[model samples]
Target: MPFPIIRLDYMQISIEKLSHAYGSVEVLNDINLTFEPGEIAVIIGPSGCGKSTLLRLMGGLEEPSKGAAYIAGQAPEGSLNPLTYIFQDFALLPWRTVAGNISLVLEDHKLSKQQSKAIIDDVLARTNLSEFHDALPHQLSGGMKQRVAIARALAVSPAFLLMDEPLSALDSQTRELLMDDLVALWSREAFSACYVTHNLAEAVRLGHKVIVLSRRPGKVREVVEISIPLNERRERAAELEEVQQQLWHMMREEALAADRELADV
Candidate 1:
């Protein structure tokens, strides 16, 4: 029997010969890629490979020096609300309660009290932070703080989510736990995400597809599709390890070349 056909609306994002520079130092060069809607694409590379810079360009935090970045069809007009970012540092306002932080962006939308409250409640439940709505940032652990960051980003209901090493700061145990939570959230929310990370294991475990970037003046080296399902694995350690090794092999030469270049500089 033939397999059922799945229709994807394909909210296509494209970058064409994009390049960015800070003064004389160039960060990205001739970078071209596309992201399809409802897909989780992770960017991985050695440190300072412009992985985060590319994400920032996608998020509209920074403009490319050359070429173009497009979402859907045309470039966004005026202020774009289609993209939101989750930072590595849980940039939660210390003074605001968990719910307050999540609701912060909603205020600008002129949402009614009832409408805002509904979204807050729903996202809180989805992120498993319903019980800590009134808690302060300091009261939560590292993993919980990142959860608040994720919840806050989701509260905006964006078309695309940009995450920059959101799990890098936590301890191993906490990172693993949050990784599971992240996979669960992605499965349920189905938001298109472009996550930047140096962790190959995290990339393999969480991404539907992974893109590896080259050294300084970063460009795409490869794009890999992950075949395993998150829920299918009873234990992720062995699977993650195997994929991690494969990813490392793919990146080994680039990483070493990058190191040598940096040392010479």
Candidate 2:
């Protein structure tokens, strides 16, 4: 069977000669890239290569010092926020239950109580959190907390997601489980995202295209495309390993150099 074709027809993201700096320190330089709708694009690089910084710029959280990232076309019709973010910290309100946390995003839109409940219910079901809808943050584990964050993001019906190592805080087993959950969600919905991570195996496992950057003052070094379908990746672990090795070869030296530089500081 062929993979289903799901596209957000007029939603293409363009990064134009993008650069960012903090006072005297430059972080990214002259970066150019494009991200199509409904595809997961993973960005991997050495420790100080500004992967998260680039994501922040793309999501409009920060202004670029010398360039711009803009969407070329319109977002999906029902999207409340055209771009939203999922951070590694989970960012859930400890005082709120899962459903309440999701409702927080919808509150500012002047929605009726019924309308808000419907949206919250939909997102919770989508993220496999329906059973935990009333659970508070402390009652859940790390992975579950991240799921709530993802659900909150989804409640907005975002056109694109800016994910900054959303799985990094979990233990290895929890991380793997969450990756599987993400794969299943993407397979069913085909939502697009720009994901940032330092883990190559994660890039290989979740990315449709992997963008590599050099050490700090990050520049686009390479963009590796994985033609394999997301649903088939688990069974094709050997093939994915080969691709991971290729990425490792490209970044190992820069990774070591970056590590040493951080140590010196």
Candidate 3:
């Protein structure tokens, strides 16, 4: 019988000298990054570069093997709302209806039935999943299921949203469509995010700043600021492509180096 205990506000997440290792082998080393409120920082790197591990650290799900992750405006783990994570797979419970899946996050919180319904309804509407409230995961298209997952995350009003290739599972066309939806949603909600992916186009299309990590045992190779205004985002398609190309070149260089190292081994 507890009441909701937190307010929804932007959170500042910063990582400093963060490193993680599994036994003697390392996955991420001296990684440093920061995500400001109202911005998306997309992280791109080769496989095994610990992009997901970095997100886990940022979400406070795992302790850093070195350095630390910091979150401003922190709250207790059991608070009504905490950090939310969206995975590449739409992790909705198959047994639950769309509405039921969204309601799962509200369970730990103390809220009147009316209030919970209101939150769920609003989120469904926001994610364009209002009509699918009665749908089951098995019945939904990949895109629709992802929207339901997004709505569930939004229902909790997380301070920061951590995503790990959340759109990777979708086909190319669906991925592109959802990317547009995400940019629009993020524009309206201003939620801070750390999105990890291997897709540079997705990174440039959605990120305010893109962080490129070197090969395995990731380290920050470069930080690129994308200044394309939202209004001009699509209109100025050339600019976005230019930025993407720049990121591609950087990544290409890193990829060659990784190949050379592998050959030596």
Candidate 4:
């Protein structure tokens, strides 16, 4: 019998009393959350609720006006980097081939040519982009482009993956497929992740624990934990719809309040 392979090490992330402001305006407020290793904790809220801003803060790309984000732990068995972000834009260089785009990330690592080739090949195979390794961005479809982005991120072997509405730009069909692929990838790799999105369906489908935020000056509203395994989520879609609706109702109230704020002005 084949035992389930497990990676011993993992990263633990914590956000304590986190708050962010732009000049005089506050975007996030006292958002306290924690992501345990091997868990997919997704954050979702109404527009202007600073979902993306929180992700950036967690990645240490932006300085928080208050509180702090911490990432201090050992990575999984094969991972090397601390964290990696997968953006919605599929930020691939047009002039670079798929393999080259992946190689771009490894350039600063000072890896030998053979070492670079090995890493690129591994990620290409992981993302199912092996055949498109030499292809340019313009030649690939939207889904393929995102795959390359994911491959590039994977090549770095990040312990934590931060995604900001990564499937927002793709068509519906492509988005659905990618969602499934993402869950499968996470389940297999067991990397800690904090995915940010406004889509509740996406949240319910991908999150092991979903963190809901309130409107403007975002606050922690609720955290929903899904007990169903990843492989069972598709078959149990209807069962999960209630969780989706519950989140929608919570977010809708804030959305309406936002509309009221706009009207008051």
Candidate 5:
């Protein structure tokens, strides 16, 4: 019998000097970052700071007008599906059942029916949606609908997950509950995630490192490492609250400036 060998310390992603623009407007400016296997990184900034655009560039959904976006040491390739995204809107098909939506991506792949079913079942269980597989998107609660979207993403088993404010739509209580579920899943699954959010508390709670972006033509302002483990999170929430307060102070000025600029235009 042969034993399988595992290499744990892999460079899952690297983005170097990545910049993007639409016509005359620059959204991202010289963004440089990296992600290691099994790490979770959160990007935080005010609205229109290009956090979502950064994720799109990272996932190869959009091209950067300059610089580079790399996944697993290579430049973003059209055929390579290393990244999966979970959208804020849930993006579930209203007409499709949970299982049907989840299996939608897999249907294109040439997999045996049993293999696909097994993967779907496993992800459904992981996301705690096994009981709701028959439910349609319209029939699910906000959190449940997001869970279905997450399950759909996980079903592909990609090496990287790009999340764009995945929990922002839910109420505070529901968001907190789903955040715990997301952390649990991350710990178990070990995929690198880049989560974008404007929520300061969420950035502190879920990130291994949180990178703050400046206002439009977004540049990296700061990157803070969160040392607490998921299980020890609540105990340190007060300490984290202080850090969150500092972050808010920094973001508040920029936010107000952004508002004023928008009002002028």
Candidate 6:
């Protein structure tokens, strides 16, 4: 029998006047926003705008210099990690088998062997990695390695996924395929996440609410809402295209200026 989809609680992530700085350099400033459970909040901005830093703050991986990034409400029962990260570089151990890579995360939770195996099996099946269970990271393509990283994230039963350019490393074709996989996975078991990406298409395709940030000392410049349902986004691609274009227009000038500033530095 398949492992049943666990009912998750109503968790809400809120960023309240959140500011952060590295030495004297301020990266993010007073970034306040809120996203509820079952929604994907995509953060997009020019490079050096601290999108990843905001994600780290959300996940409590770093302490902000000022303000707060906090979650309200309980994580689902049996969640080993309430907040999990899926990084751009599929950070799997080079030597571990697919199953072993997943098992590593569970080890710290002290789950019984049976529980660990069950979690691993369930996530692998959900991610369509069942047949590749014993494969090493090197044996898989770029997309498949990412799929394993995703499956590993799922094994922890995350309340919120802090994805930092999770698909940016893949070629265009592979990235497209992975986006489809993500939408399909979301359809099965609704999950919440703060996804950081520089790609506007990715922001439009995956984000329920796309939060656009300004250049350095990044602040919430705009929050563009997509009313289309996730399952219908493909058929409604034209509409999403317009929204994507709108986002591009909003970021274009700042992006250019941000680029020039980097060039000078």
List the candidate numbers ranked by lDDT, top first: 2, 6, 4, 5, 3, 1
lDDT of 1 at 249: 93
Candidates in order have lDDT scores of 0.83, 0.91, 0.84, 0.87, 0.84, 0.91
Residue pairs whose backbone atoms clash in candidate 2: none
lDDT of 2 by residue, 17-92 (tens): 9999988789999999888788999999999799999999999999999989978667887788889999999999
The regions of model 5 sitting more than 4 angstroms off are: 1-11, 73-80, 263-265
Residue-level lDDT for 88 in candidate 5: 96
**Candidate 3 total steric clashes:** 0
**lDDT tens digits by residue: candidate 6, 41-156:** 99999998999999989898899999997777888888889899999999999999999999999999888899999999999999999999999999999999999999999999
- Taking the tens digit of each residue's C-alpha lDDT, what string does model 4 give over 1-265? 4433343465778888899998877889998887877888989998778899999999989999999997656676656567899999999999999999999989988789999999999999998889998999999999999999999999988888999999989998999999988988977887778899888888999899999988888899999898888778989999889889988888899988876665211
Q: Tens digits of per-residue lDDT for model 5 on 1-265?
A: 3322233434467788899988888888999887766778999988888899999998888989999887554323321245889999999988889999988888988878998899889989988889997988888999999999999998887778899999999999999999889878877766678999999989988888989899988999988888888667867989889878988987998787776665211
Clashing pairs in 4: none
Better of 4 and 6 by lDDT: 6
RMSD of each: 4.4, 3.8, 5.8, 4.8, 5.3, 5.3
What lDDT does model 2 reach? 0.91
Backbone clashes (count) for model 6 = 0
lDDT (tens digit, per residue) of candidate 3 on 98-130: 999999889878888999999999999999888
Alpha carbon lDDT at 139, candidate 1: 98
C-alpha lDDT of residue 186 in model 6:
87
TM-score of each: 0.89, 0.95, 0.90, 0.93, 0.91, 0.95
- Clash pairs, model 1 backbone: none
Residues 112-140 of candidate 1: C-alpha lDDT, one tens digit per residue: 89988998998899888999999999999
Angstrom error of the Cα, residue 188, model 6: value is: 1.2
